[model samples]
Target: MCVVPTVIGVMSGFFSLLPDLLPMILPSEVQITKASDLEAQRGGKDAPMIRQGAVIGKSDRMCATVLIAKPRCSSAVHHHGEQETIIYAASGKGMRHELSPGDFAFIPPWTEHQEINDTDENVVWILIRSGPEPVVVYLTGWGGDEAKADSID
Candidate 1:
């Protein structure tokens, strides 16, 4: 029996075309700069302002959103479905677990929780949750003021 080489094509032309077939990957530094530029364009001077970016509206799978919260800003005490979540601190400092960065606590389903940004700089974080859809019902604080009862329930 004749054995054939297991290797694919080793042509120089094919190798050179690899980059063309694949999209160029941007470094993290470049990505951070781009994000900063976008934020700068929409950023405004105001107290307790929220800049929601990405994954708005309704969807089936888990949703992802970026929340840019300013100082003294807080999201009222609320609870959602039996969905698990992880809030990642993207930048700046904040009081999540009544402490600094990497000090987050688990919030069980239907458990009421609120986040406040006490620092001067804006606190950016990613909210990730897996479920049918997130339905946050505000009981007290800022959520009680703006959101409708029907929307939350």
Candidate 2:
């Protein structure tokens, strides 16, 4: 019998023993980034998907950014190593070809994906990753031959 699954299940459920403490935020520890102050961070040499407005970057286990996708734009193929991501469509019609505003999508670790906008309207998504910093590994193509470049720094 496989004991790995049993062990992992038990370990993952450890949080049930303790109460989730999100309501205990301290006033001094709260940090806010204004929309006008959002920084412009870049992606890979070939992948320019980042016209992003970074919000909660440098977190110990999460990074959040507002991504703006231009009309008729398709980003390079890439994957986040060991980091899962959750995307929330904040605005934009999303139309019939994309995620509508208020929609959400989750991407697992090491999953190869691309952000594509095939409509005439711009799309905006809030990207949140489970990592202190994003680990973008740009690829040549789907099921890429190998990594073209690794890590964003």
Candidate 3:
């Protein structure tokens, strides 16, 4: 079994037993951008056009991220071992195996899935995934950096 160290903190100056006690903070700002902006920056790169901030990595057992995607943008079908995920749509609408905002879906370990934005505007969401060094394997679709890809596979 893989042993993942954990850290616990107290309100009044805490001590961390693990090698690292990473703090997860809610972003204070949200910036909206168009698909055109992403296209200009990527130059046709097959990457998720992130219009806002996204949680790419975290040191904790669970990592939370926020992402904004323009219409028609989709995530690749992927799966991982010992990892589960929950996605909450904050705004806009989309389809994820018959799921949308105000709707919650639990992706089990090794389950193949992807996300798509069908609206003309942007779709915003909060995603949370848990596991020790959780690995996400992309089966199909597009958009991910080298580090992100390496972590998943």
Q: Quote each prediction's TM-score.
A: 0.54, 0.67, 0.52
Off by over 4 Å in 2: 1-28, 39-48, 93-97, 147-153
For candidate 3, write residues 18-53 as lDDT tens digits.
Answer: 233532333335444455543454443344545322
Better of 1 and 3 by lDDT: 1
The lDDT per prediction is 0.61, 0.71, 0.59
> By lDDT, who's the top model here?
2
lDDT (tens digit, per residue) of candidate 2 on 22-95: 43542336677766665435443234244564745656789887777767777667788899999899876442
Pairs with backbone N, CA or C atoms under 3 Å apart (clashes), candidate 3: 47-143, 48-143, 136-152
Clash pairs detected, candidate 1: none
Stretch of 10 with least lDDT, candidate 1: 25-34
Report the Cα RMSD per candidate.
Answer: 9.6, 8.7, 10.7
Model 2, position 46, has a per-residue lDDT of: 37
Best of the two (1, 2) by TM-score: 2
lDDT of 1 by residue, 10-45 (tens): 466667887666545532232222466546646555
In model 3, the runs with Cα more than 4 Å from the true position are 1-48, 51-59, 132-134, 141-153
